[model samples]
Target chain A: MHRDGRAFAHKSSSQQELPMSRAYNFAAGPAALPEPVLRQVQAELLEWDGVRASVAEISHRSPEFMRVATEAEADLRRLLSIPGDYAVLFLSGGATTQQALVALNFAAPGQVADYVVSGHWGKVAIKQAKDYVRANVAASGEAGGFRDIPQAAEWKLSKDAAYVHMTANETIHGVEFRPEWGALPETGDVPLVADFSSSIASEPLDVSRYGVVYAGAQKNLGPVGVTVVIVRRDLLERAGQPRADIFNYASHANAGSMLNTPPSFNWYLAGLVFKWMLAEGGVEEFARRSAEKARLLYAAIDGSDGFYRNEVAPGVRSRMNVPFFLRDDALTAAFLAGAKDAGLLALKGHRVLGGIRASLYNAMPVDGVRALADFMQDFRKRHG
Target chain B: MHRDGRAFAHKSSSQQELPMSRAYNFAAGPAALPEPVLRQVQAELLEWDGVRASVAEISHRSPEFMRVATEAEADLRRLLSIPGDYAVLFLSGGATTQQALVALNFAAPGQVADYVVSGHWGKVAIKQAKDYVRANVAASGEAGGFRDIPQAAEWKLSKDAAYVHMTANETIHGVEFRPEWGALPETGDVPLVADFSSSIASEPLDVSRYGVVYAGAQKNLGPVGVTVVIVRRDLLERAGQPRADIFNYASHANAGSMLNTPPSFNWYLAGLVFKWMLAEGGVEEFARRSAEKARLLYAAIDGSDGFYRNEVAPGVRSRMNVPFFLRDDALTAAFLAGAKDAGLLALKGHRVLGGIRASLYNAMPVDGVRALADFMQDFRKRHG
Candidate 1:
């Protein structure tokens, strides 16, 4: 029923043209989606899967929607290469809620949980978990304005820590733990939990290395309302603390994440995205495009000869979010307005870091980034 | 861009025909929405409000989206005639999650909370709150199989109860605290909290009467992901319990429900619903339609000489959900299959109470109920 098959025919190429009124959106989270996925959703807005009703209007427990839910988890499992030992949960409340849940589900009441802070999201993770656990900031980059990840030797991990938490990538601060930043420290028996909200599925991930990988499905994933939590099955056995049955991960996992009515429309949209990602050759292909996109954009900023500046250290620059500032900060408003006029939307920086931030998510075509790079050069030539 | 304005023009008239392939869907919650709203969504799936992107693809914090959020709250306030002393919150996670949060936000740790159990959802509220509060079952209809709400005098409220909790309507048991049932008890200084998930806007509501009124948007509202919570402003001062900041209601209220990334797309859809409700004459119009729809279906059931049966007591019978049984239980499969062929869908019963159920929320047109009534009579004539 989709009317636009031609748009997705060449999925990986940087040459595809955007549809009319569809701009190169650079918003972080609640970000852009693949045109083909949006087309499919529009096509089936009235009748879905021969059910004679919209997917959003059907019962989540209906056999028709249960099939949708099952296929989504299966496709996500295949896309991420998640291990069989890991149970995938499609939940609501975004990553912040999951931040609190990780502590309530895995840590004993008032037990110490070590946190390796790298940026704004890392601090948020600690803020959410502190009430449930004795949150210990094992390491922090805040001292340097979160420009880089602290050296692993600087971390003062607790001997009796319940788990070591980290933000895999920070959306606002544009900081990430790249391979060059050094491998995450081995916590021995203590499991490592990472918030991969902005970075999951942007590259191939080693699922077996961590105890829990949770993300709000808004950035590299499809939508904003649903969250995906990949937990090692054994972690479900932890009787961490007294919480409601609705707050229990094991209970949700046992019920196939249908302990209550889920965000079915968001989950279904994520499923469409999963199918698109698989069709575009999964995380491995995304990694290649991501590297290419990041290299091009970083090269443009670095070649500007101080016309533009990105404060993040080169070693840990986020491939997903590239936050940069013009040499004259007063010109920020003109740059954003000019970009919007050029059909580049949501280029304004987040309130936490007020400059220009372009988020290159999986749905962002390589062409979109190229357009942004071209726009940056054009703006620099005009203002320099 | 909407192709069919004709469909919605005669919205309240039973003579209006269903659109092609559109069935009379009766599934509870994640239920059928107004066709006009779906048409608008489909028309704007690619570009929304000149933003050059789908509403789903924009940042919730952006001014474009902030306007949508604010208008939604304002329209809802106008529709419900909510007082200035109330605070409205648009949150993720459904009614079940709020059931847990109510205790964590309003009651002291291990403090007594009174519960009036009318149906399955009431029992669920207690289950979610038992860990955080001293749950006192002040009254229960379980002894009578939840066929009716107990008399107001039968309630045994605690002297120092934090709040009195009740489900405004029972979706599964086909029971409700209808006006004919009786006025609610006066709790002196204690506030009354109600779960209005299945019946919120179906009639004119006295918002000032309840301390907190919460409903998942899936049923009578709009979609499945977002929830609307209205609380008396005075209740925000309670210490409640030590919980994560994300779980705190006061924090969400103070942040304008944008404390983190909200379910923006769902909230926008709900905003569309609010506008439609206002345009179609608000809660007063819905109340008239609900009474008419409920009358037609119940008359068909009662008119049948034992062929169709609804066990809910007439005084407390829900105008929203009508559950019934066929005289010959073995014909259940044939009845459901026949209904599906006749374009009357989701007639299958909830697993909790195994029998056919038809939910007539605000969006379910009176004509759809008339179709179900006619189909029931035709089936009885052929099967009997």
Candidate 2:
């Protein structure tokens, strides 16, 4: 780090030559970027190939920035094997927008939207969309307190529903679907939309499984400014029929996502993360690492004699976030405080779900998991 | 200026004491930010205190980032004299959304709205709103080739209009209205709405004057991801029905702009720019510099007899952007090419408005004008 012409590095490179400065981040979204991606952004921050400005500070309408915009969408398309029938669009606002947007663009006024209330995220989605269109709980797991995914057979499919919406993984509840994509309830061609925010880029996803897919770029992907949406091309054209343009993904896609000024810096960072994901053995390696990280953390929880326990079903345990509680709830705060003193942070659970949560996203290397697991064990010993 | 333990300044900065490294940037939006603000962001890119991360890389939900969001809104309100009756919203999409959003939020289904189409920006606004509701041009300067604002006498106000909309400044067409709280256009008791994208923050306005005012944070404020909207509190709960909640000012305001993961980095950058503006003599000083810079550039054009020209009506000329043309049309490319070689970039005009444009926004120092005028004189001596 350089400040006022002074360079500072905490220490020399490791004995095995591993980079010592990488953060073992466990943030939920904009969570953790690959170490190499951050370095790439730093290198290109001041000047990009003869252009005398940072990519973030440049005009989005400029030719150079345009290259980045298109290349990012292209790379994302290649990574996800996005079908030709789909129009991949980059948007601003998080999944919260999609809750309202999916309803506005897809459903006619007063049409019911079938929502699967799996966890906290789904509840918020349904709450927001209720303002736009009628929301029907086709399925819910609140009976089980979001501890399991609703089986497809359990949903009461609506005859007049415009589409069915589900969150593939709930970061708050730490309940994930067994399959990468959620099971489609039989709805007779009623389009399905999935919020893949927490799970985006963690593994290969079948783009053909749904009519629309949207992800906020905070965890696993990149930073906090942009959202990636891949929607069927047919759905894009349908958006402008009676809907306003800005909220209509088709209008944005038609204009190359420049229907308005974009979140240029975040878009550029997302591109860097996508490039990093591509180079780091693609999603296959990410899936392997993500599963491994989840397994180690869960196994440690299960191995404990009720010192730490997670109620979410095994098949549905999230690969990105794992929420657990100490047997004696009084020890939770001390465990978190001790973990932070040992250089671990954001180990707290969701506000609605009070407990300890270690979000092990794609950026969490095996070493980070070991460190977290080590802290968990140490904290348990100190408190138990 | 240290990249790797060594001091390095771009040759442009090192070559002069003028900080010509801060050249005149005129790419419209995502255009030139204040030089000091850009330097400040670059300085803080890697670490922000004990957080050990760029503000952009932080989670939007974190307590540290929430402070950035809340304080930015507070500072903006103080700077704009925002009324207690109004809600200030920080959104992602630019002023373009406000076009449809204003209609969606204020104009209910089956109701009509009025628009004053002054130039390209207003035209874009008009076109976008027409997609959602029955919007008619209350007035227009299309006959004047969008070179001037319509006189107050010409506005044909609608008696049942939900709100009256206007672009306070036309970025491309080089026209601007004097800062008034926000004046009504012939409609009694009806609210006033203005898209002040190009001219906001240049001066203080009476907040009680308008129902809504919006500006994108590319040129005058900061980076390009977020937008600023100041709306009367009553209007938020009333008329306009939105097709999308993300672009809807009410939803964003209701959520404290944290309804979703915000563009945290851009929000932070905008806050820094606001603080910079406030520190550097507030809105009054910004106005003084803007008027001075625009005056210098216009003087050079108005002084050039048959060599150069600007066609906008003198009284309504934009202090932010000055579009001029050379008498000899063929010299345009050589002029721009020479300007860049001399460190003046993005001075090219919009393709539709051929010739040269020197957007002398708040960030542009008077020195950029002297350099450009000098370059213009040299180019004319050879080509005139």
Candidate 3:
């Protein structure tokens, strides 16, 4: 089960006796953490780094916590190959808050921000953006049932748009924009803001390509409270006039993300997860394994004889979230129940698109996907 | 040390061996957590309630998490004696975010929101509110060097003001609005909003008096990241038009604080804290203990003839945060260094104040205060 030789025996006594038999959770976000990271957190829960206080109890201003925060930002920057000119902000409120903040900070008064609406997240972003500025849906895939990403050529990107916004990966629809798909033609000097919540750290990314890239640290990162925001230094100048200090990116950057009391414990855990990623050969290895995991699960669905189906286009199928359906809807309940019984949990799809979704985030071991594939085959043989 | 007869043997092997010696953290916020809660978290870090996943790994939508969230809210309601008409929201971005959100939600265009500028936090709130509406300072303690809460008679209550805003306790200045100070006159219909960040859960209050009471769950509650906002149901109707979903109070209320994936682990920890509070006889006992803790520490400062002093008016001195000073300014650094060496962590005052502050939050045991008092007496004797 250990792929990177990075797996060390969990030192916590409670972790040792817990039956190694555990569920392979597939919940979308606030999802499974790397087992080692969880163990490390557990071990350090009572006393962190020989300090008497739990990481959660220490003051964010204390040197001990400041070290954790600085290291987290440094590791994230290193992992992403982020430039010195970019500010790495560990913030709260996840991507949903960022959706509004991005618009508030960048969408200038009387200026349009072009939005490429690909899936549920994109739509949500646009809805939030409209509250602050002219949120123009330059292109939308709703007409095509969000099965695929719309071509850049199809987007009527505004010539003078303040910025261009897109969801790099949509967890609900299992749609992802590959690096090539991220290329917007001839939008002169307009910054690109990407909500990389579900896909961040799952693969290598060109940090310089986007003006802003934010991800909730729930899926591939560590926990739910903290968010990783990598914003190009220059874009900070474009931050709209006099917003709430908490919502102000510049304020956070200036204060080292301790503008107010940060989610200290979450930030520390995220640092641990980042270190684990580095030790395990970085995001490149994660990309390879993530692709393989997606392939295995997709292959199971595609190979099924009219039993299982995935609607996302082959070219843009997400490598992290693989959403599929049982062709005979009647068997879905049985399939999910059996999956749960077999230690496969949270396989149910979004309520809007009901069937199943296997979120294969970085922490989701390849064997978990294989187990799901094996289960899909058995279920099809039993009912198909 | 186990005053409540609740201290259990530290069964975790790691805890059993670590020198039972630990520093007393006197951080203003992101302060101490109950020792028992930390141990419980350490024990349950990997498997929560026999579930084969860490609490952090579980989905917020999962039935198990829903129970935690629901119970947390119920216990908080019971502890605060919150009226049924109040919507208890577990949010993120801390009190700083709520300051802006309150302005965004309650400040109507062209309408003034009266702010009682008592200290640093109140002034900051007033400044943030100015961007959204006419933030009128009805009363200010700044003229008095923030030494005391202004009399209600001195407040220039605006008859048509949108809302009256105040900080129930100023952590930095160590001034608090006692119950009598909180009663505003001739502003019958105008909603009173209080930032109870540092003092919340330290005592019981008549919750129906305020339209909105918000606290960052770092001081007396649990950890950072999660903020508890208890807003009257009627004030929700006044939430201004078309705001960011995350910033909208109604959005959180309608979603039961799950508008987006909440900080689930923080929420769970907060629930544990609420249970701890209940087990320790709720806010009433905390209030009694808090008063006693403050009394002990203040006595040490006051009894030190010209050696140690606190400028804050005795009538308004905060029971949660006690900011003090060494009369011999040159000895301040030595005082802090000696305090830290004696295992009193974060005893230094905030940078702006440049002296000493001993925050006595609910989790701070009376023994910790006694130790601090004894240390203060010894240090004064040596220096004098």
Worst lDDT window (10 residues) for model 2 chain B?
A: B1-10
Docking class of 3: acceptable
| Predictions in order: chain A TM-score | 0.95, 0.92, 0.93
Tell me the spans in candidate 3 whose CA falls farther than 4 Å from its real position: A1-20, A179-186, A239-242, B1-20, B179-186, B239-242
Q: Choose the strongest candidate by TM-score.
A: 1
lDDT of 1 by residue, B98-161 (tens): 9999999999999999999999999999999999999999999999999988999999999999
lDDT of 2 by residue, A1-384 (tens): 011232221122331254223246677766766665655565555555355556655678888789889889888988788899999888887788777788878887778889988898988888777766788999899989999977888788788788889898899999887764355655667878999999988888988889999998888778777888889887765532366567777778888988888888888888877877777778888899888888889988998899999999877888988999999989888887787667576788888889988887776677788888888888777777
Q: Candidate 2: where are CA atoms >4 Å away? A: A1-23, A180-188, A239-241, B1-22, B131-133, B179-188, B242-248
Which number leads on lDDT?
1
When summed lDDT is taken over every stretch of 10 residues in candidate 1 chain A, the lowest stretch is A1-10
State candidate 3's DockQ.
Answer: 0.35
Clashing residue pairs in candidate 1 are: none
Colliding residue pairs in candidate 2: A29-A218, A29-A219, A30-A218, A30-A219, B85-B233, B86-B233, B104-B240, B104-B241, B105-B240, B106-B240
- How do all the candidates rank in terms of lDDT, highest first? 1, 3, 2
Predicted candidate 3 versus true structure: per-residue lDDT over B281-351, tens digit per residue: 88999999998998899999889997999998878889988898898999999998898778888888988
